[model samples]
Target: MSDGITKIKEEFDKKVAEIKALMKNPQQDTGLLSNSVDFRDKNLIYSNSDGVFTSSKDKIENYPAKGYPYKRGVKLSFSADGTTELEVEAGGGDDLYGICTDIDEFTGMATVVPITNNFTGYLTFKKNGNGVNPGDKLHFNAQGELEKNGGNDKSVNAIALSKVHKLTEELSIVLASVFGNRALKGN
Candidate 1:
């Protein structure tokens, strides 16, 4: 069973490579164009700035799931072992992180969007007693979720976009930025 699965995967990867090659070339042959429509419709094919063609969508990445079943919208960080492996814990000091968008249980991969400088997007955050108002400086709480009440030790640097009641499980959207020093300092 495993051998059959591996064969299927290999074939699929080969076809994907061919499709990527066709998309990269300036003049694509009609034959290669036949199977390319499906991928393009999903916005999965593109020629990147570095002149390499990849199927990865903009701002989305597939990383190996160190801990399987990462919940949708959970904050993620690169494990200490490598950059491509993802874990649910908040990274310590200067480490970059992303929000979980989806999880592929079959492949054990987690889809995430890396929070970069000036990135404006939605992230799941645990609400504090203040209930997270706009302009509140957010830092990673102990569980790797966002909270405005965090102390000086943790710094993820996300700002609340929409207000969430303290009764809610988490805040749904935030403006994540890596620039400047908007980090929360403990009182």
Candidate 2:
């Protein structure tokens, strides 16, 4: 079976190389016109330093009008479970640290719930006039779980175990398939 698969792959590679070589130099149609104007009238008018001419007003209107201005700002949020690390940053300012549940100055309190069994959070920054932009890091702690300092660590452990259980089942199937092929070859 391995030999057959290798032979098929070699033939496929050869065919692809042949097709690529055929497409290298395509024949051009002589009937098609080569000479054409690359610049548009609107682009030519906008490029002029002197500005656009007005017929009735007897004045030149500058490219950019006065009304347009740029506006900008920043915001951050975070979450985690079990034993997870959180990082916080204010624009041109100090970095802050805390657990998933613990609140920071930017995100006042825990409002959003965890989507998965794991914890999740986001840091969002925005320009006032435009839409929000994300910070460098957006993270979810897959191995971590929500935990109280003392009690209820067992409950968090149980949730983490459940996620591990699902992953183990998937990995087992993949390993079985890989090893099964080796066993068959040995036979």
Candidate 3:
């Protein structure tokens, strides 16, 4: 009957829409192939709350941006008031939360790409008193810029992935998950 065919077509369309939605947020669609080994073993990156493909180990969440139009790759901190704030102090607290991925101009929301073991993005580092070399352990400075860790007291957030000799020249860094804890040796 025509009615039966129409119902089937409508069901098919609904299923298709569900699949597309699951692809966008696979974690929420636990009914599909989420339990399959193929999906688990693939280590596939999934879209986060901001529709950004992030490592399966990390979750990028949107936050109310205290200031709109944050530069991509700038360090962001979670404030006590529950808004994401731009870093301004030097080693104040464990304010080093995540990096800014994207911003919604209309909503003034910032997508925070969490720093996790799977994080492989590049970070810009600032030159310290002795300059920076590859393999140097880095910590956040006054402007949330990476600076050489003078000793074990500072949190080793990242390791320099490139060399920088001049004040104007900037370099990239890799997140130091192994030694990223704050005051690992002193405390």
Candidate 4:
């Protein structure tokens, strides 16, 4: 059964790659033009600067550089001044910046959530005030950790995704969906 699943996955990946290649080079087959139209109608694909179709439309807008493990709901951007390595932005200086979504750390790359989508990640809830839950708003600390509003933290970001529940009263790491503001334009 495992082998069957693996084979199915491999074939699916191969077909997707073929479709991507065909989309990249439309001249390969005029029939592919119609295929692209069909694909675009069904998928919410965003074009990268390089003009290549991405593997998934969900979390990644395009392929991440090697060793970057951003799955879904997170986008990456580079700090212009080089002062900050990775930044999860809540508000862009222009007020176009969205909100916090996920809490995964990649040392060499900057990450952000999409302005118009819902994202989920494992985040630590605040231990203060009986702790946080699915409907609570959150902010990211300087260290890239998520916390509730009302600290030195200025960003009053909130969760857009629903979180799973645990019966224990202790503060625990749980999966959560965060919403609002894009950290960067580039994925």
Candidate 5:
């Protein structure tokens, strides 16, 4: 009988440890929702004549010489039970520059706009543009003050975690109490 009780306790402890581990280091998945613009899709016009010198012909060249054209809507996902800090970064190829504007968090989407300041590496682009570079990545803390706003802010905050943890803890306590009572009765 004692051995059986010990086994049950061990099993409960092991399960609790697993849950704690998951809570401690939650999993996060990030995705690009949208980009800035399709530079290649734009038409560049020029006028020219065969015999006489004329304006250049319209050339449809892809911008961002290296990366894909920036789309309008872009987003990254960070998942956790509690509030988590986040950072955003961008790499400009040629004509592309860092986005400017509050990151919209309504739909977990980021709106990138063209800005004169260059962001090269890991730097915060929200408050000041001093350390900005050509291809710097932007960092967005929990405050959600970066060029993007909305969904990112909520996702990184503690609201979701607090709710989930509360429910989980309640369930755990109830389950433990029930199991303990049953053991006592059996004894």
Candidate 6:
């Protein structure tokens, strides 16, 4: 009887571990392909990846030092080909890649936008010049801002992890999950 109880406890623990793992990788735990998934705005102002739940102002001084800051941490003065030189071309490609997670309540300025992946979190980045819906799909335009997903362009960099509640406010910031690798393009 004791052995049976131990086995049951072990099985329960294993199932618990599996559920925790699923929550940690919300992006992957689902069977719905990125294309078929329908994202919705759940009004989640900030998640573990977005940093602390403080008023936007309080987060400003904390921004640069934060784990998933929007701006790129390093700049490349040379091309990846060892000694080939390159100039610092300004635009979008150099910054973070997901969606905007937080904006100042009063100023309406965007604050947090995480672009990279981690052992346990999703992220956000800026929007492209055009508008996007919650589940509309997205990718990096040449400038690096989130653009409509490229069907087969080899640059389909990400998928909208959540929907933007456009009726409430224009989606100045969006929450997204980056594609670890390039996925299919639509056109």
lDDT of each prediction vs. the true structure? 0.51, 0.23, 0.51, 0.43, 0.27, 0.42
User: For residues 40-99, what per-residue lDDT tens digits would candidate 3 score against the true structure?
Assistant: 433242244323335565655666665432322334545667555643112222655565
Model 1 TM? 0.47
RMSD of every candidate to native, in Å, equals: 14.9, 26.9, 10.5, 14.5, 29.0, 16.9
Residue 159 lDDT in candidate 3: 60
Please report the TM-score between candidate 6 and the true structure: 0.34
Clashes of each: 0, 3, 0, 11, 32, 13
**Which 10 residues in a row give candidate 6 its minimum summed lDDT?**
58-67
Q: How many angstroms is residue 101 displaced in model 1 relative to the true structure, after the best TM-score fit?
A: 2.2
- Please give, for residues 80-104, the per-residue lDDT of candidate 1 as tens digits: 7665654654332344465454567
List, residue by residue over 1-187, the lDDT tens digit for candidate 6: 9999999999999999988876645376455434343475333335433443222222221121222223221112343456554322112333433333344445433443333432112332354334665565665543434566545544555556555433233234455555433444564
- What candidate 6 gets wrong by more than 4 Å, as runs, is 1-75, 79-131, 150-154, 165-171
lDDT of 4 by residue, 70-133 (tens): 2222234545566545443322323323233222345433333344544455544433424555
Give per-residue lDDT, candidate 2, residue 97. Answer: 16
**Span of 10 residues, lowest total lDDT, candidate 5:** 172-181
The estimated TM-scores of all candidates read: 0.47, 0.14, 0.47, 0.34, 0.17, 0.34
Q: Which candidate is the best by TM-score?
A: 3
On TM-score, the stronger of 1 and 4 is: 1
Show where candidate 3 strays beyond 4 Å.
Answer: 1-54, 68-93, 127-130, 165-187
Rate residue 2 of model 1 by lDDT: 100
Model 2 agreement with the true structure over 65-113: per-residue lDDT tens digits: 1111100001132333433333222221111111122222343422211
Candidate 1 residue pairs that clash: none
lDDT (C-alpha) at residue 88 in model 5: 31
lDDT of 5: 0.27
Off by over 4 Å in 5: 22-115, 119-187
